[model samples]
Target: MTDFPFLGILTLLPLVGAIVVALIPRRNGELAKTIAFVWSLAVLVLTIVMWVAFKVGGDRFQFHESYAWIPSWDARFTFAADGIALVMLMLIAVLTPVVILASWHDVESSPDGAKRSVPTYFALLLAFEFTMIGVFAAADVFLFYAFFEVMLIPMYFIIGSFGGPRRQYAAVKFFLYSLVGGLFMLASVIGLWVVGGHTFDFAKLVESVNSIDQNTARWLFLGFFVAFAVKAPFFPFHTWLPDAGGAAPAGAAALLVGVMDKVGTFGILRYCLPLFPEASRWFAPAALVLAVIGIIYAALLAVGQNDLKRLVSYTSIAHFGFIGIGIFAFTTQAGTGAVLYMVNHGLATGLLFIVVGMYVARRKSSLVSDFGGAGKLTPVLAGVLLFAGLASLALPGTAPFVSEFLVLIGTFSVHKAYAVIATAGIILAAAYALWLVQRTTQGTLNPALEEIPAMRKDITLREKVVVAPLILLLILLGFYPKPVIDVINPAVQATMQDVGKTDPGPTSVVANGGAR
Candidate 1:
C-alpha cells in the first residue's frame, strides 16, 4: 500500500537473481534451473503487484525515484514508470519466465566434465530481463542508453552459444548491427544532453530540448531513430532478424523477437516523438512509406518461406511494419493501437514460437514440409497451433483484431493511400497464415513422419499454463481494450500535443479520417 519506489525494486530483483544463478556451482544444473524459475516467477509476481498498485488515472510518471549519481556532468540515478513503461514492463515480466520454462531441458555441457549447462543460460536470460526493464523504467537519457546498449551482450551469447548451425554468423551479425546502432544512439544522447544545457534527466531534457535547432535536432533524432529501427529491424535494417530468429533456439527467439524487438518502435513513441516533436512531424511521411512497404514486403516473404520458424520471423517483420506506421502516423487511436500492438504481438508471437519449438523438438526439423498431417496425429498441439495462428492473423475476438483495426482507422485519417495499400497486407497475412496451417496440420501424413510416434499426447500442463494467459489476454484485450486504452490514450494525446497543436483541417482530416 506504500507509494515507495516499488518499480525500482521490481527492476533490481532479477539482477539479484542473475548474480545468484551465475555464482551457483556449474554441477548443480537442476538446482540452477529451480532457482532461476523461482527468481523469474518472483519478478513476475512483483510486476503484477506493481501493475495492480499503479494509478491508471494519473496522467504522469509514477513511482518516481531520483538520486544524484554524477552531478558534475549532470547525470543522475533516476527511474520512473509512466503508462508506456508499465505496459513494456508487464510484457517483459510475463514473458521471461515462460521462456525460461521453454528452455528447461536445454542445459548443455562443455567437454572435460565441466557442468556449466543451465546456469549460464539462466544467468544470461535474467540479465537480459534486467536490461529490458531498465530500458522501460529509465528516467535518465544516459541510463536508458546504457541499458539499451548493454542488452546486446546477453542476447549475443544466448544465440551464439545455443543456436542452430549458423549460430556464430547470426550472433555476430546481430551484435554488429546492434553495436553500430548503439554507438550512434550514444552520440544522439550526448547531443541531446548538450542541447538541453547538459541535463540527462529525461523529463528535464525534454523540457529544455525545445530550443535545439531544427536541422541539428532532426539529425540527432535520426541517430536515435536508427538505433531503435535497427532493433525493431525495420525494413532494410531487418535482414538480420530472420537470420537471428532462424538460428536461435525457440526460447531465445521468443524473447529476442517477441519482447526485445518492440523496444525499437517503443523508443520511437517514447523518446523520438516527445523529445524531437518537429523532427517526428517532419519525417512522418517518409517513415509511413517505409512502414507500408515493409508491411507488404515482409508478408510476401512470409508467404514464400518453407521454414516454419523463418516464416514466423518474417511475419513479425510485417507486424512491426504496422506498429511503425502507427507510431509515425501520430493520431491518438494510432498511437494507442501501436502500444496495444506491442502487447498483442508479444503474446501472439511468443505463443507461435512456443508451438513451433514443440514441433521442432518432435520432428527434429523446422521445415514446413516435414510436418504434414500433424493435426491428425496430435489434436491438442494442432488445436493450440491453429489458435495461435488465427490470433496472429488478427481473427476477430482475438487480441490483434482491435489493435489492427485501430491502426488502420488511425492511418486512414492521415495516410489514406498507404493505408489502402497496407490493407492488402491483411489479405497477404491470411494467405501466409493459412498456408502455414495447411502445410503443417492439414495434409496427408508423411511416411517419414508417420513412423515416429507423437512424443507428446497433448500440450503439456506447463505448455497450457504458458499459453493460457496469453490466449486469455489476447481475447480480453481485443474486446475490453478500455482498461489499456484509457491509460494509453492520455499518454498518446500528451505526446501528440508535445509534437505541436493538431490542425483540424488537413492534419486532422489526414490523421483522423476526415479527409479519407
Candidate 2:
C-alpha cells in the first residue's frame, strides 16, 4: 500500500491542472482548453494504470495511504480504494475526458449571444474532478465530509456561470439543498468523533461507535441518511435535480448526475450500514418505502416533462430510487447491483446528456416539440440517443438491465411487495424512453427546421468519439458483468456480515413445479 502515493497523485494532478489552467491568460481560451484536456487525459491514463496495479479479490482497500493531519483530534489525510471506490474513480476518470470534449466549444459561447471565458469553465471542471476523486478515495470520515462539501463549490460556479437562463436560481437551489444536507452530515461527523473517543478514522469510528446506545446511533444514522437521501435526491428531496440539470451545461449536468450525486449512495453503503447496523435495520423498512415511492413518482414525472434535459434529470431521480432500494434491501446480490448501478448509470445517463447537448447545439432548443423526424436528418445522432435511452430503460442486453435485474430479484427475495411495486418503474421507464425517441425521431419533420442544413447534419467526428465508448461499454458490461461483480461481491459480502445478515438460499423446485 505504501509503494506509491497513487491516490494522492490521482487527486492532485487535476487540482494542479486547474491551477495551471486558471493562471493562463483569459484570452488564451484554446490553450487553456487544450491543457485541461491533456491533463484530464493524463489523469485517465494514470487511473487505468492504477486499475492495472490494483489487486482484485484481496484486501478490501488497496493503494492505501494515510498521514496524520491533526494528531490531537485523530483526523488524518487518509486515502484508499475499495472495489466500490475504484469503480467510481474509473467513472470519474472516464467521464472527465468526455466532458472536456463535449464542452470544448459549448462553453466558449453562451445561449444569450454572449462570449464566455473558456479557461474559467474548464478550470472549474478540473477542480470538480479533483473533489470527485477525493470523495471516492477519502478513507477518513472527516476527509470524506470535507471532500463531499467542497465538491459543491465548483459545481455551483459551473451552473451559475455557464448554465441556462435561470442559472443563478438553479445554482443557488442546488447549493442550498446540498449545503443543508452537508450540515446534517457534518453534525453526524462530529457526533462520531465525540462517541468514538475523538477519532475520525472510519474503521475506528465504526468499531467504537457501534457500542454506543441504540437511540444515539439511530439519530446519527438519520443525520447521515437525510444527507444521503437529499444528495441521492430521493423523492421529496429531489426537486433540485431537474432545475440544476435543466439549467447547467450538458457536461456539468453529466458530472453532476453521473459521478458526484453518487457520493450519497456511496456514503450510505460505506458509512450508514456498517457503522450503525442496528439503526440501519430499524430504518430499512421506512427507507425502502421512500425508495419505492421515488421510483414511481420520478418515472411518472419524467413521462410528463417536455424539456429534454429535465426529462433526463427525472429519470436519474428514478434510477437513484432503484439504487436506494438495492442498498437498503440487505442482500448481497442487491448491494452488488447497487454499486454496479452507479457505474452503469454514469455511462448511460452521461451519454444521454451529451447527446442532448448535441441536439441543443444544432436545434437551439431542448423542448420535445422542437425536434421531429430528427433520425431522418441525423441518423447517427438519433441512433445514439435511442441506444442511450434504451439503456436508460434497462432494456435487455444493455448495462442497466443487469444491475436493475439483480436489484429487483434480490429485493424480491427479501421484501416481495417493494420489489413488485418497483417493477412498475420499469414499465414507466419504457414509456418515457420510447416516448422520447418517438417524439424526437420518428415523427414528421418540424417545418421550422426544414431549411436548416446544420439541423440535418449528423453528429461530428468529435461527438462520435465522445459517445461511442459509452455505447460500447453499455453493451460490453451488459453481456459480461462478471469482472465488475467479482470485485464488488467480496466487499458486499463483508458489508452484509457487518450488518449481521446473509442472502437467503434459493429454493429448489421439483419436477412437478412444487418448491422443495
Candidate 3:
C-alpha cells in the first residue's frame, strides 16, 4: 500500500497554511497575501504530485489512508482517491491558486469600511480550501460528511462578512439551508452505519447496503438524496442559491456555486447510486422528471433576471438540473457527460463571477441595464465576458457544448420526453445568454455608465493570469477531453457493474471516446 501519511499531509497542508496566514500581522498585508499565494501554490503542487502518483488503472480507491478517530462510532480519519475524486482533486488544485489571485486585488489589508479583519477573511478562505479538498479526498463516509459540513463555516463568513449589502441575510439563509440538509444527510449516514454492520468504511458500507431491504433502502437513499439535492440546489430546494450567489464576493461565490455544488451530485454518483441501486433505479425517473422541471423553470426565471450575478446563478441551477438528470439517466454517456459538465461548469461559472466582479468594481452595479455599451468602454473585458458567456450557453466550440450534447444524447436514450424538455432549456439558455451579452456588451453606451470609470482598468495582469488557464482548457476540452473521459470511463464502468448491468452500446463507446 502507498503511504497513508502522505495523503494525510496533503489533506492537512492547506489547513495549516490557513492557520499560518491567519496569524500573520494585520499590517503585513503584503506578507499575508504572499503567504497565502505560496500556501495555495504549494498545495496545488502537492496535489499535482499526488495525481502523478495516483494509479488510475485500478478501480479500487488509491492513496488509501486511515486512522482511528472515533472508535465507538466506528468513524475513522480516512481518505483516498478514485478516478472521480481525483478529477475533483485536480479541479480544486487548479482553481485554488486562480481564486487566490482573483482575490489578490480585492481582499486588501483595509478595503475601507470593511468589518471584522481582512486577514480573517483570507484565513477563512484558505480554511475553506482545506475542507473542500478533504471532502473530495475522504474515503470514510463520516470523514467525508465532516469535511462537507465544515465547508459552510468559512463560506458563511466569506459571504456574510465580505459580501454585499444583504450579506447577513444571504449568509444566514445559506447556513440554515445547508445545516438542515446536512442534518438529513447525517441521519442517512447513521442509518448506513447501522445497516452496514456499524462500518463507516465507504467500500464496505456499499457492499452491506446492497443486501438491505428495498423499503429501508429507499428511505435511506432519500435522506442522502435530499441533502445532495439541496446542495446541488435542484428545483424547489434551490431557493437560496441566487441570494447566496448575489451576495457572496466573487471568489467565494466561485467556490460555492462552482466547486461546492458539485459535491451534491458527486455524493449521488459516488454513494447513492452504487450503495442503493434498487432505490436509485426506482427513483431515477422521478429524479429525472424533477431535474427537467428545474431546467425549464430556472431557465425561464433566468430570462427575467435584472441582476447579472443572480441571473448567472439561475443559469447554474438550470445547468445543474441537467447534471442531475444526466447522472440519474444511468447511461454511460450521460454519466460521463455529467462528470465533465461538473468540471466545465466550475471553470466557466467561476470565470463568469470573476468577470462580473470586475465589471461591478468599475461600473458599480450588477444590473444588466447598467452594463449597456460596455464593449465600447472596455473591449477586452467585454470580450472575456462574451467568451465566458458562450461557454455558459454551450456554444458548439466551447466547453459546455460537448458535455451538454453528451448529456442530452445519453438522457434521450433512456427517457425521450425528459431529454426533449431538457433540450428546451438549451433554447432558454441561448436566449438569456445572448440577451445578457447584448445588453451588457453590444449596445450603445449608457450615459450614466460613462462616469462610472473605464471597465476596472481593462482586466489586470493578475486577473489575466487567473483566468488564462481556464480559458485555454475551455477551448482545448471543447475539442478534446480524452484525458478526463479515460479516467471516468473505468470508474463509470465499475459503478454500472455494481448497479447490475452493462452495455457496450453507441453512447458507451462515445463516452469512452471522451466528450465526442
Q: Rate the local accuracy (lDDT) of all candidates.
A: 0.85, 0.92, 0.85
Error of 1 at 115 (Å): 8.2
Per-residue lDDT of candidate 3, residues 346-392 (tens digit): 98998888888788767767889777888887888889999999999
Error of model 1, residue 288, in angstroms: 0.4
What lDDT score is found at residue 500 in candidate 3?
Answer: 68
User: What shift in Å separates residue 475 of candidate 2 from its native position after superposition?
Assistant: 1.0
Best by TM-score: 2
Ranking of models by lDDT: 2, 1, 3
Most lDDT-accurate candidate: 2
lDDT of 2 by residue, 1-516 (tens): 336889999989999999999999989999999999999999999998888787777888788899879898899999988888998899999999999999988987778888888899999999999999999999999999999999999999999999998899999999999999999989988988888788999878767855788999999999999999889888788999999999999999999999888999999999999899999999999999999999999999999999999999999999999999999999998999999999999999999998998898788888999888988889889999999999999999999999999999999998999999999999999999999989988889788776777797898999989998898899999999998888788888888888888899888999999996
Q: In model 3, which residue pairs have backbone atoms overlapping below 3 Å? A: none
Q: Answer with 2 or 3, whichever has the higher lDDT.
A: 2
Candidate 3 ranges beyond 4 A from true positions: 1-6, 109-112, 454-456, 504-516
User: On residues 1-516, what C-alpha lDDT tens digit does candidate 1 reach at each position?
Assistant: 536777678778889999999999888887888898899999998888888888877747888888788888778778888888888899899899988887776547422234445788899999999989988888888888888988999999988887777878999999999999888899999888778888888888788667999999999999999999899978888999998999888888999889999889888888998899999989888888889889999999999999888899999999999998888877887888888888889989998988888888777788897878888777888888888899889988988999999998888887788779988999998999889988998889777777776543567787777778777888898789888777677777887888883523443356555653
TM-scores for all candidates? 0.95, 0.98, 0.95
TM-score for candidate 2, residues paired by index: 0.98
